[model samples]
Target chain A: MIQNLTTVWRFRHFLLALVRLDLRLRYRRSILGVGWSLLNPIAMTIVFALVFSKILGGDDLTRYVPHLLIGLAVWGFLKESATAGSRAFLQSESYIRQSPLPLGIYPLRVVLGQAIHSTIAIAVAVVVTLVYQPYQPEPTDPLAILSIVPGLILMFLVAWSAATIFAFVNVYFQDTQHLLEVAAQLLFFLTPIIYTAGKLVGKAWWWLELNPVQIILELIRTPLMKGHPPTADRLLAGLYLAVVMITLAAGTAAWLRKRVIFHL
Target chain B: MAKIALTDVSLTFTVHQRKRVTLKEYLIQTVVHRRSISTAVSVHALAGVNLSLRDGDRLGVIGHNGAGKSTLLKLLAGIYPPTVGTREVEGKICSLFDISLGFEPEATGWDNISYRAFLQGESPASLRGKMDGIAAFTELGSFLDVPVRHYSAGMMMRLAFSIATAIEPEVLLIDEVLAVGDMAFQEKAQARMKEMMGSARIMVLVAHDLKTIRKMCNRAIWMQQGRVMGAGPTDEVVDAYIASVTRTAAA
Candidate 1:
């Protein structure tokens, strides 16, 4: 595992170049590039804010709008990683056949590409919260801002691992991407992105803690929106989620990395 | 000290007979392993091969298609791991098997260069110095700025070869990529291939062109059906490989 990390770190520049290549190709014939990609989610966020603000987190547009924005940003990262990560190795079959780099970087390519657009959305969310003076506790720590650095790192770990799993899974089952796309649509409604977590008053609400994404979202949202880092329990929860994901990724990679080119 | 050693190596690919197997079917097959109705059939691409190499070895591999010549190169390059044996390679290996396949068609020649170079393990700092050399070699001029999808096959291959060879390889693995580019560029590519082969500590090439192999390599191997049919001095191997081919044709 350490060796794998070192291999990926050694090729950090390659990953950056691939991400840039993906960015340029994505915007090759289209303008409003990222804005257009995010338009759907941004539109969805607005609709949710208008519909559920009063019903859930209260009618405060300041609090609710930023919340929805952050939620959708993370959702975008998760969704794009699933959809694009499945094609990561398939698209790079030439590279895989030509040389031996760590198989991990291929999925990282997809994760990094998705991360950029989500980063922009997250930045916009932060700005909105600042503009709203943040609907937070009166004595929230100003130093909590530093937590965003760790927050982003944790988010990347989660995204990269999820993408690695999806990439390997898709190599084995060609329809994994199609299945995930349908699954993602269901996940959107099931996740608290459109509906506030606070409003869930039933038995299923207890299992929300098991939703690693919810933990990931709160880690970023607390520091950015509430002007305070999430409580220790939440941070630990995020850490556990990251560990679990990395394990799943490592497991999938161990099983499929060597023979992936055969399938490709 | 670049070196390569394969100890009793074999590679088997379990190719699905179908175009693809869905997760549902795969899961069902896995659960019902004994009574499975799966179409998974294993292809033995390489079988019980032993080879050794060191610095100053320019090894030529000749074989009919599907005889595992390219597979041996890929296995040496670490793209495909051996199923039953150990492969040990030292030094940075640069393989040029599918150099022209990964380019994004909608991206320009310049962009394709960056992408391919990076995949071949060139960092921005390293590529910056080599950019002018690569650009000059392609000679596409303003055409470099145009999307590669618009470029002819020969032009695309030219761009790919230039970028692929930009990295100074310590060990090179090539699979019949010398036959690319236009008439002039073909000679240029041949010279570049020679230059790269000359500089690398070790080089392995898989090709059907016996004359090119005999010219470029001091050592050669002839493979048939995933096994080595001949190995030794290039002249003897080439003669034997030709005899085998002629015998098959006559029969």
Candidate 2:
């Protein structure tokens, strides 16, 4: 494990270059360029706010817009990373066949690339929060900035591990790419993105507890949306999930690293 | 010193007949019959291949298509581990099986160069000085500024070959990549390869052109059906391989 980390660190520039390549290729020849990253979530949030505010029968636009924006941005990050990272290996099959670099870098490249877009979306969310401060839930504590540190770290760790696992599985089982697409759509509605988790009162709330995404989402949403650090329970949940995902990612890579080249 | 040694190395590829099976189909198949939905066929790509190389060995590999020539190079390059035997390699190996393997067409030639080098484990800090030399070698001066998508196939191959050969590797495994560019550039590339071979501790060249192999390699191995048929001086192996091919043709 230490050796793997060191190898990845040595090739950090490679990872950064791949991420830059991904971002550049994604928006290449487009007039808006990377502006699309910020525009996408903003557009989604507007549509969701319009539809959900009417369904919930609420005129409080500011309160729900920020909530929906932040949640959607986080969800978008997870969805893109998971889907893109799963195909990272297949996409770089040529490089894998020719180069001798560590195989793990492909998944890292996908996560980092999506992380950049996610960061842009989060920045837009912060701007929305400030603009709609009067109507939205005001941040209660300045210490919330500190909470974002662990929050962002945990968020990235979970996404990275999940992407790595998906990348490995997708190599052998090409169905994983399509499976993740459907799963991401299902997970979006299931997670408390469009609606607030607080609305579910009784046994239904336990459903949220069962979702690992809920804890990962709260890691960011609690500090960013609620203006406070995540509860100790949420933090512990994120930590536990991170441990399990990281172990699984490492185990899968070790077990399948040699064989993945053949599948590719 | 660069070295590679394989003791009874073998590789098998377990290919699934149906690569993509939906989750629903898989689950139903598993729950209903407790069996896999897709059948897997295992192909023995390489079998009981034993070889050893040390410093100053310019080894040539000649074989018919699908005879595991590329697999041997991949095993030496660390792209694939031996399925059965023990394999050990000590070197900063560079394998050039496909020159245009990693080029992002939407990226500029400058970026592609850096990207390819980085994939070969070359750090940006270390590659900065070498970039100019590589660009000069490609002769794609102003063209390097534009995206690689606009470059012609030969132009792209030039860029790829230049970047791939920028650094003198401790061990170099090449697969018929020397037949690149126009005649002038091919001669230049051959000269550059010779210079690289002079510095490289070990070199493995896999090519179908017997004359090229005999010219460049001191020793050669002929593979037939995933096993080494003959191994010895390049001239002897080439002569025997050619004799057998022509004899079969005459028959």
* Candidate number of the best TM-score: 1
Which window of ten consecutive residues has the lowest lDDT sum in model 1 chain B? B29-38
Candidate 1 lDDT, tens digit per residue, A1-264?
A: 789889888778777877887887775676787676667667877778767765555557877787888888888888888788888888877778776788888888888888886777777777776777664675377777678777678889988888889888888788899999999988777778766787766887666888767888888888877687778998888889889999999998998888888888
Q: Global CA lDDT of candidate 2, please?
A: 0.84
Give the alpha carbon lDDT tens digit for every residue of B16-54 in model 1.
777677887777777767456567899999999999999
Instruction: Give the chain A TM-score for each candidate.
Output: 0.92, 0.94
TM-score, cand. 1 vs. native: 0.92
In angstroms, give how far residue B103 of model 1 lies from its true place. Answer: 1.2
Clashing pairs in 1: none
Model 1 CAPRI quality: medium
lDDT score, candidate 2, position A160: 90
lDDT of each: 0.84, 0.84
lDDT per residue as tens, model 2, B88-147: 889888777667776887889999999888877788788989999999999889999999
